[model samples]
Target: MNQAGMISTSVSTTTMISGSHLFNISGHSITKELPAGKCIMSSPFVVGGYQWAIMYYPNGLNSYDQPGIAFTLELQSEGSGVEARLEFCLVDSHGRPSDIHKASSFCEFGYVSCNRGFSGFITHEELEESWYLRNDSFVVKCTVGILDSSVVEASGCGTPGNANDTHQAEHLPPSDLHEQLRKLLESGEGADVEFNVDGQIFSAHRCILAARSPVFHAQFFGPIGEKNFHNIEVEDMEAVVFKVLLQYLYTDVLPDLNEFGSIQIKETSASAIMAQHLLAAADRYSIERLKMICEEKLLGTISIDTVATTLALAEQHGCGRLNEACIEFLSRGGNLKEVMDTDGFGHLMLSCPSMFNLILANINDPNVLRDLVIRFSKTSIKS
Candidate 1:
């Protein structure tokens, strides 16, 4: 080799500003009289130039069912995409955070709102029974950490280059293999295999499908190859879902679910519906990466109306993380009762009765379940 080429580079640095605020409930018992969805907020404080406040919901927050005490850190000032990490814990007798109950969360506040906190910071029974609640009062400590990153320019000599003899180096463009593959999938110029899905035919290359999915590989080249190779009949999957599956198999990218409006799940977004169907297809084809992508998308869409159905889906597909998250979401505020009122909740109970034990495990208060069953029975009678 003649000589190595040198190029200057710029480095980035990040600075973190952290501060803690304490909200003390003087008469904790009195605050419990407040209804769910009502909150008492601490005085606004500034940390890293952003104003924030601690919202304390003695009964619960954002719901009519009062299952637990909730706390949320709210950004007082208007800001978009403000990233921060929050830690909420009850202060002990010594003014230090008690390890008994602590919740940590990271959030990127968007334009619509800036609130990130735990709905079940601590269950009512747990808080009343714990030593952290002293003299009929309790103190909640919130630690906020805001990160500020900046790029700092620094000069340095590289490769011990000779100044007298200067040379120009050619730079190569980034690879567009994925784009080319996407184009190939769209064109169907050399498709060797065809799939019949719900009366719709999709053409694809066997080699590309085999490279991406193990199930496809076995079907094309393994023992399953004894069957016809030219035309394959896919079962129980919609034409749209199979098309998206083929697209993912060809290119490593998953298209936005909103692109297609052919199927819509009631009370759920188009993306969520697509993700639900695609997750099942991905699981069937043994496409793990696609399965994970769909899982992550579903995680973001979990809400009171959708959590029950999502939980059922998680149980059916053996998605451990999704299952745990749904259980955790149910344990918060009045979410469980709210979800119980939905049709999906009925379906969940009927389809996955095994999930009851896991749900019971996360619930701190037993009376809530008792009340839920009684209330649900009354609602059933009325219906």
Candidate 2:
């Protein structure tokens, strides 16, 4: 035997061909076409320098290890072409032979060249070329591309979902105090009345005269109620007092310091004196313009007696500004002594003795103490 050229009996023992092929060559008759269409190709075919594995139907009823084989045989051809395609058929351990379907008749062969050691197949399309196939498995290969680059650029600028919808208003300059007050006083009359005072307009509704003083009512209602006062009447003394009261009411602007000529200094009297109660009432009702007017008037006409009354009212109603002003006025030297010596000083003093002490502690003049002692002695004699 030519040992090198001979087919060894040992090799034939391991690689045996049986079943239908053997029967057909032996001239034996067999029924059926060997169930050809039901047969599938089995794995491991070599072409070029690469080994091709069998492809499986995605919906085939088989496990990953038990593939229903069908694969393309790819090869580099010598002078035949750049590439060639081949097809195959297989048989299982049973006598079932694979149906010999069409071969490479419908397939298109193509060549791919890649850098040595790079180890991957490249396709014409960029997206497809970025995939690696090895041993029948496909994996994504990381590569820079337009999609990732664009996303990185956008992220560098900002996050995807942040836009503000709210906008703030611009600041305005301060207004003229007296001009604003004048305008407020001039605005009209009635239950539902609108008036402009100190740069703001005030609106009041369902209001009535709680006291019969035309001047007092005028200040309370502004020009609107002032106009209505033409139809109202009062006796001489009441009308005079009401006129002074009305002046205090209209502007929260008080009369000159000289106007308190002969009036008594009591809670109602002091409130009536400067009309601060009216301003306070306006503040209580949320009439901003009126409250400003009242505040302005209180600042202009602040006095020892009025401060005493206002301090008490301010403390009761939590009016911090008014309370501060009262403290400031009493802190001045002459005012506290004057308040303690006035006709109803004892009554006023009794209502706010702490305020008196606060005044005494703050007064800078030594004479203020002497005056307070003399005034208390006179009050005791009268009582």
Candidate 3:
């Protein structure tokens, strides 16, 4: 109804819906045990007809430069696009939002950019002293507002008004293939092969092992494949190590170091001992991913008592980065003298005599060189 004697129609107006979710994270100290980039996801919540979740990283996102914890908003449902306003705030002891540590942002959630987060939402030091943290537990409130809008048009004449089209996207759950495989491994269902390791028997499927390891494939299915496929005896690898290797082959997860103990052959952390043996077993089986995991574990647990032996293991296994890192750590002030006095150092000397040259090349301190020469000469004379 207008001055032009024609009717104009408006299709729709903008709408917004908002909701909040609170995450209760207990055992905060235990959560910190997880490595950087590892995260705990909150349960999914629905707001404005879409599902969303929160991702909390106790040790930040990047493996290096972890200044604080990280928090991210994740869109769990697939959709065309969503415009959202997100706010994350810690709940204080009295159940109110903490004023000092609040973060807010307006972001678009789509297939291409489905995740938005803060790297350092709050520093570790600040959080430790803040009242928001209590009893090794904390709560975070996440608020989300979903915005939807349709084109508003001023149309003249009898031209039909255009309507916005919306499609229903299917909701897909996260994959649990690894979990199913782990169940298969645990249940020993349909297992066609058996392995005897150090008097302990393990049952597994030949196809799965063949699929996971090239060595197993050649041993089980190749032209020179084993004539008796039902029973295979593995040598040199411990039963526990073989058990962990099979778990990784099926589940692709690292072993829990707490479940294992030190090898007792040296004065080193339990994790370092387990990782050392796993590294050797990984090399023998040609599992590159497991090898890399063992390497990272060893690198993180390096100490004066373990570095020399670790360096020798790295050299024998051709872990170049680990080899260089060990050399670099040993070259630092006073580390050489301390490491040389340990039993691991004697083993390192005997196993890798040429590594002395590598260590000397990295050392620039004259006093360190003199002490190293004296130590080496004495060890040599003693041997």
User: Clash number for every model?
Assistant: 0, 14, 0
Write down the TM-score of every candidate: 0.59, 0.28, 0.56
For candidate 3, the lDDT comes to: 0.81
Summing lDDT over every window of 10 consecutive residues in candidate 3, give the lowest-scoring window. Answer: 161-170
lDDT scores in order: 0.79, 0.39, 0.81
Across 1-383, the per-residue lDDT of candidate 2 in tens digits comes to 33343221111112211111111111111211232223222233333334333322221222332222222232223222222223332221233322221122223334432111111112112111111111223321111111111111122221223221111112344556645544444444343444333333344332332333333445556655455423333322322234333344444554553455443434434434545545545444455555565565665556655665666655655565565556555545456767665544575455555555655555556787777767655655665
| Error of model 3, residue 137, in angstroms | 48
Sorted on TM-score, highest at the top, how do the candidates line up?
Answer: 1, 3, 2
Greater-TM-score candidate between 1 and 2: 1
Model 1, 277-383: lDDT tens digits are 89999999899999999998988898887888889999999887687667767876667877877888877777787777667655556777886567545545554
> What TM-score would you give candidate 2 relative to the actual structure?
0.28
Top-lDDT candidate index: 3
| Candidates sorted on lDDT, descending | 3, 1, 2
Where model 2 places Cα greater than 4 Å from the true spot, the runs are 1-274, 283-289, 304-313, 344-347, 373-383
TM-score of structure candidate 1:
0.59
